[model samples]
Every structure is written in structure tokens, then in C-alpha cells.
Target: MKRGVSAVFLDRDGTINVDYGYVYEKEKLQFIDGAVQGLKLLQAAGYKLIIVTNQSGIARGFFSIEQMEEFHKNMLDKLAEEGVVISRIYYCPHLNGCECRKPQLKLFYQAQKEFDLDFAKSYVIGDKLRDLALCEKEPVKGYLINAEKKIIAKDKNIIICNNLLSAAKDIVGFKNHESY
Candidate 1:
């Protein structure tokens, strides 16, 4: 995906931080090691850092939308301390039958409009299959974080990374690689 000047679509729960299932509390936010550094690397490489997450916690009544926003604000504030700036974060709070949900490509399209993203140049990273689903419809690449080795398929365009740090390395490589 060397199409240039594209965004990096990320899944929040497991990709950026630990997913404690409907995790909302700010204190519950445990960032994956190297998550911030990876984001920073992407940001420095001129890639837009956008988060596309599914937060069914709000729809499930486990948390409120306001609470989720506040938590995200806290997350942004924390990341800012480390010189990381997330361009935007999009989340779908639907349990079912929503086009904005992952695997639907709705949010990615929306992001394209607002962020001027080139899908062919973009990247998606997540712990689940839906995170990489956008790649199926677009020409970009996807990275599946196999922290547990639960995903056991050899996807052609999808790279398997041990963590976000490894994914960041590849992203940087892709950006700097001349033959990309």
C-alpha cells in the first residue's frame, strides 16, 4: 500500500489497548506496549491515524455515549503527553444490523470523505477478522494481530503480526520501500 498519503484505520479495543470486553473506564485503559510508538511512527510518516472501533458497550447499555467520548478524550490526553496525535476516532455502537459496524465498510467510506483517504494506500489493524474486512473490499493491506494465534489462515494481503509494534515496522517499511 504505497499509494501515498493515506490513513491507517485502527481498531481500538484490542488493537490500541487491552480489550476487557466493553471496556469504558479510563482506568481500564491498558495500552498495548508499543501502541503509542507505532502510532507515532505512522504519524511521522505522514499517515493519518484514525481509529475505527466497535463500541457495543453503549448500545448494550453497559456504558453511555457520553461516557465513551469522555474516555476517548482521556485516551487522547494521555497519548498527547507522549507526542502522539490521533487525527480522529470513529466508533460504531450498534449490536447488529448497522452499516457503520466493522465488516460493513461504512465507516471506512465515511473516513475517506472526511480524511481524503486513498483506500489503496491505507492500512487496517485489528485482532479480529472484521478489522481486516475493509481490505477485502479495497485495495489496501490488512494486518491481523495474532497475539493468541487464534487466527490461523494465510491471507495473501493480510499480514500476521505479533503485535502493533511489528505491524508498525512493516508499515514504515512499506512507506520507505522503493519497489512498493
Candidate 2:
């Protein structure tokens, strides 16, 4: 039997880079503070990093798929330069009501099957409540990034953090050590 791998499912727009509304240009790519370091820590801790994003801009005609791909390529290249290796990216280029969009489980199930993921040991991290939808359906823990600390979660499986790095730190049990 193949062992299930643990993974960290991440959101791209507001969670990773600054959300400049319908961002599709490489020139506008900006990593949120501690995002790179957070990913590095997760990767180092043996979590397979995967990005699950909803690129509604494609559906809204704000950007083409090619442009989004180029932006993703540039972002991936930059992350690579920083020694962060993303295992894969699963995106739903659709508007609200798409089965594959965030808060939906289509993409999540696909990743689970492809990776033989261990839900008990995995996590989902993003800046929106929809990003933590996996927690409602699966045993995977969720980290909701709310820098303002405004959103309140009633689910015990969900943890709200100020940013991705804080979530990463909590995931790897480095909540107290802050020298990274």
C-alpha cells in the first residue's frame, strides 16, 4: 500500500501575492510579507506544497489564460529562485458557482487522488473563509489568513492567522521561535 503524503494547499491571490484585482501581469507580482519564508518552512518540514487558486479573472474577461499562465510562470520562477519548489498548481478559471472554485471540493478531491494525500496530516491555507472549506468536508486542518483579525471561526479545525508565515509557524510547531 502506498503511504498517503501530507500536503499544504495554498491560495494564490491575496494569500500569496498582493491582490491587485485581476492580477495577471508579471510586473505586478509581489510576495506578501513572510509568504516566501512561510513556504520555505513548510517545504522544509516535508509538506508537499500545492497551490489551489480560483482565477475568476479568466471568466470575467479581465485576463486571458495565457496571461495568467505567464504570471504564474513568473511567480513560480521567482519562488524557485528562492528555493521553494511547488509540487503542482490546480486552478479553476471560472466565476462563482463553478464546481471547481474555492469553497468547492472538485479541485481538492483531484489533488487528494493525485497525491494520495493524508487528510489527517494535511492543511489548507488562504485568506478567505472559502479557502478553509476543505476543513468542513475533510479532516484536513485549515489556516485562515486574516491580517486584521476580523474574521471569527467557530470550527475547531480552523485557525486564523495574521498571515501565511504565522500559519506556517503554527503548522510546524514554531509558534514561539521567530528568528526565521
Candidate 3:
């Protein structure tokens, strides 16, 4: 890994694409407004794009792991067609309380180990407080998306944005500011 290699850990549903609960079909996937552009911006800024999602639906029997993999394949193909490449995707197929669930650091740990990431320069962007809470260590900034600002007021360290585009801009801005 390059020295100072940073990663942007993203939550798949709601943050990347529209959260159709337990989504496992490529035909059903929908990208939120500005999501592609936002992700592209992050990519241009040299952040490794890693997806960390909790797919409890697999454990709930709503969708098989193969179905999820197919869905991800379709999603990645679509992104590739758009010139966006996701570095990796890590998902937790276990039910609640699983070590890899959001708010837990299991997936983060795995990513760090696999990628040799500089957690101090990384960030985690998601639609839930749990996503932000997952990165309590150094260089792991948290960004929350909730236009209504309902679940994030308690955390002063969290940056809240109305959409993915705005969140990307905020993260880029923060990174630039820190470099000065």
C-alpha cells in the first residue's frame, strides 16, 4: 500500500443507492441524485472507495448471498460503465449483533488489515448515526446524511449533509483544510 493511503468507507444503501429494504435485484437499484458525481469527485481526490454494508437480509432469508453478489456485480458493472471503480465491498451476512454490523468495527478492521489503510486519513460516510459511530479512531471522519437532521444532532464531530454531493464536497473540503 502507498504511504498515507486513505480510504473512504461508504455505506451502500440509502447513502449510495436508494434504500429499497433488502435490495438484491439490479433491476430494482436506483442511484440517488448526484451520487455518481459525488463518488467520482471522491475518486478524483485519490480516496480508495470501499463499501461497507450490513446485509442482514441475507441472514433473514430475504435474499441469498449469491443473490446479493449478483446484485453487487450488476451495480459494479453499471458503475464501471460510468467510469467509477469501487476498490472493494465488504458485507456482513450475519444477523444483528454480528461483529461486522454497522456501528461495529469488524468490517473496518478487516478493511484496514486487507488494504493497509491509513485510518488517520480515512473517512466513513453513511446515512445513519451507527455509520459515523463506527469510526471513533484517528483520521476516520464521520459524515451523516439526513436532510432533516434528526439522528445526528447529538454528535458534534459528525458532518451532516443533505445529499451525497454535498457530503462529498464537505469531505473534500475538510481534507483540503487539514492539509493546509
Candidate 4:
């Protein structure tokens, strides 16, 4: 565990890739506009990119985790083609009310323990409020990529942005911890 390893945690659906409701196929994967660029920018700025996603489809039997992993590998290959390195990916397969699920601190804390993350200086970027919930327990800052355009957030620890690109810009620009 390193003390100064800053990270930018991201949501998988809608933030990095387009969310089309239980998308689990390689052919169905679509990178959101500026996603590659944004990731690259964050990487260049010395931030490790990590993904913490909630994929309840597994709990619902809509898809197996092995299927998800295959498709996820495909997604990672595409990102690697563009030189975007995702440091780690952690997901919850539970339908709800699980320790590793979002709005819960388990996955983030686990990642923290494994990666030696500096929660105080880290950041979270996602499309939904739960994606930013880790901020409720820790001082980590957050940015919401409001791709859905339907959520009305009032949390002071979170900043709302139009998309991943804008969020990345804010993140890299506010490296000194200016909460957007």
C-alpha cells in the first residue's frame, strides 16, 4: 500500500461506456464520447483509473459473471488499443443490500486496502448518486457524469458534469482538491 497513490474511481455504464440496459456482449459495447481521451488525460496527470460498478444482472440471472468477464475483457482490449489502462475493476454481483455493492463502502475500502489509496485525495466519477456515495463516509471528492440527465443531485461533495470528458477536465484541473 502506497500512501500517495491517487485514483479516480469511475462507473462502468454510462460514464465510460454507453449504458444500454444489461449490455453483455462485445458487439454491444460502445465507448462514450471522449471516454478514451478522458481516461488518457487522467492517466497522464498521474491518476490511477479504477472502476467500481454495480452489475446486479448477475444476481438476477440475466448473465453469468463469466460472461461479464469475457465481455469486460473485450472492453479492456479496446481501451488498451487506445493506451488507456484501467488499474482495477471491482463489481458487485448482488441484487441489493450486499457489502460489496455501491452505496456500501466495502468495494471501495477493499480497493483502498489493496491499492493503498489515499481516500482523502482520491476522486469518483459516475453517472448516478450511488456512484458517489463513498464520499458520504470518506472525504474523497466526486464528479457526476450526468449522462442520464435525469438525476437531481444536491450533495455538496459532488460536482455534476455533462460527460466523462468534462469530468476528467475538472478532475485534472482541480488536482489541488477544489471540489470542481
Residue 143 of model 1 has an lDDT of 90
Residue 37 displacement (Å), model 3 = 0.4
In model 1, residue pairs whose N, Cα or C atoms come closer than 3 Å (at least 3 residues apart or on different chains), thus clashing, are: none
After superposing candidate 4, which stretches have Cα over 4 Å from the reference? 147-150, 174-180
Output the number of the TM-score-best candidate.
2
**Cα RMSD (Å) between model 4 and the true structure?**
3.8
lDDT accuracy of residue 111 in candidate 4:
87
By lDDT rank, best first, the candidates go: 2, 4, 1, 3
lDDT of 4 by residue, 113-164 (tens): 8888898889999988889999888888889886456666677888888888
Candidate 2, residues 1-180: lDDT per residue as tens digits? 778999999999889899989889999899999999999999999999999999999999999999999998999999999999998989999998779998898998999999899989999999888988999998989998964566788899998888999999999998555577
Considering summed lDDT, which 10 consecutive residues are worst modelled in model 2? 145-154
Error of 4 at 116 (Å): 0.5
Overall lDDT per candidate, in order of appearance: 0.85, 0.92, 0.83, 0.86
Model 2: number of backbone collisions: 0
Give the lowest summed-lDDT range of ten residues in model 1.
171-180
Task: Report residue 25 deviation for candidate 3 (angstroms).
Answer: 1.1
lDDT of 3 by residue, 1-180 (tens): 368678888999999999979989889989988888888888988999999998989999999999999999999999899888999999999888777887788888888889888888888888887777655655577888854645544555678777777788887774542232
Clashing pairs in 2: none
Model 2 score (lDDT): 0.92
